[model samples]
Target: MEPLDKEQQLERLYATPPVYEWELIVNPMHFRTKFACLLSLTFTFIGVGIFILLPSLKGLMIASSPIIVGSLMYPWSRYLLNADKRHYYAINKYGMYSTSEQIIPEIAYTIVRRSAWVGCAICVFAAIFIGPIAFVGAGGAALMSFTMTNFRSVPHKSQCLFDGYAKLRNYRENEYSLYTEYYHYGFDLMIPESKLMSIIGVIKQYNDTFEEEFVDLYKDSKFQARPIILEIVR
Candidate 1:
């Protein structure tokens, strides 16, 4: 085999760092529990308020409101849960087998903005209802909103090796890409697809040794002048 270059050495170090046991995180945000609480509490309060206070509904809200609110909230919760599952699975279970190289800034922006706006709208509507029951429902909506906005579990929870950077794939076209938070310039190393097991070591080594070098190298560089590369490791 050809001797590895300095960059290759660094990449290898990151992909296969020494470790005892890989940490597996499931349900990192506790969203499953959070959603359950939200649904249960919102319906519980509404059920009681409508059945006892109004009495005309005759516990109708308990039976029917759940279906209505559930129809609206379930889809949102399902989407949020799926997003969380994808992220956690990648980091904790799959161990970064393959990653897209294009550090698309637009993708992150769109995801964040859309999620935020949707969450904010739900919370705002709940807030406007205005009553003790409204307060409880609004609280549930607000929690869901905050959770959805910050749903990605890996980076936020400090599991990834490098912090990522956002790049414009196409400025006028609005295409974008994402990069490791601290990456070296002129040294794009995409791990081979068949070498999936090596990624854990690679990430571990990269974080342990060269994280500082990677960050310092491009910390002051002009954004318009950065080379983008992606790695697809086994």
Candidate 2:
């Protein structure tokens, strides 16, 4: 789907947010997630190899690839392909919040961006020395991104429009995610399919109905002078 423009993004804010709470699970077995992890470990291995064979500025980048990839990419991969742990979350006017259905809620955060750089970083480094390897790595990253985007779950608030990016998909049963704000303190709502259409309609109508009222409030706010009267009551 095409990306939401600013107006649509704002309109989405009008929906009462749905909160999804599930036990945190980063299932690394999914093909796309595993592929991302494989790319990460591969670069880490190459970095280690460079550090062992030719330790220098060039070798340092190869070696540091692990940290860069580990910090930046692994977390992202796990989030995109998180496990379906059983939990409960609720949404209200204040914010989307969750409570742990289990004793421990360990998920920390979800990544919104696919860190393709992790896959290609090594390739670029290799280009400085081994051109062919870079091409292979870049190609793999491009391929991985295709799968990654298919299952990607961008983060949304508890009260978000039910259509577009916030819409839940039960077909795969894996394209939803969550982050631990504290132990069971945040929400990752997975709306039911049966109710999805009605909820979307209700929210859209509410937003549309109030569009003029909210936008034109300032236009009708012109002040009128009147005789001043002051009263004091004790």
The lDDT per prediction is 0.38, 0.40
* lDDT (Cα, tens digit) per residue for candidate 1, span 94-180: 122222211223455457546656656644654454334543434544555566565443443212224333221222111112235
| Stretches of candidate 1 exceeding 4 Å from the true structure | 1-12, 15-52, 55-69, 83-133, 150-234
Off by over 4 Å in 2: 1-46, 63-67, 85-114, 117-122, 125-130, 133-151, 154-234
lDDT of 2 by residue, 1-234 (tens): 998874565455445464322233232243556656776677556556656875766556445545455444565555433433333444333233433221222333213233443445454655677445434323444345434434332343343332212222222232233222221321233434344454345434433221111122224545421111111110
TM-score of 1: 0.30
Clashes of each: 25, 6
In model 1, the worst 10-residue window by lDDT is 167-176
Give candidate 1's error at residue 222 in angstroms.
Answer: 56
| Candidate of highest TM-score | 1
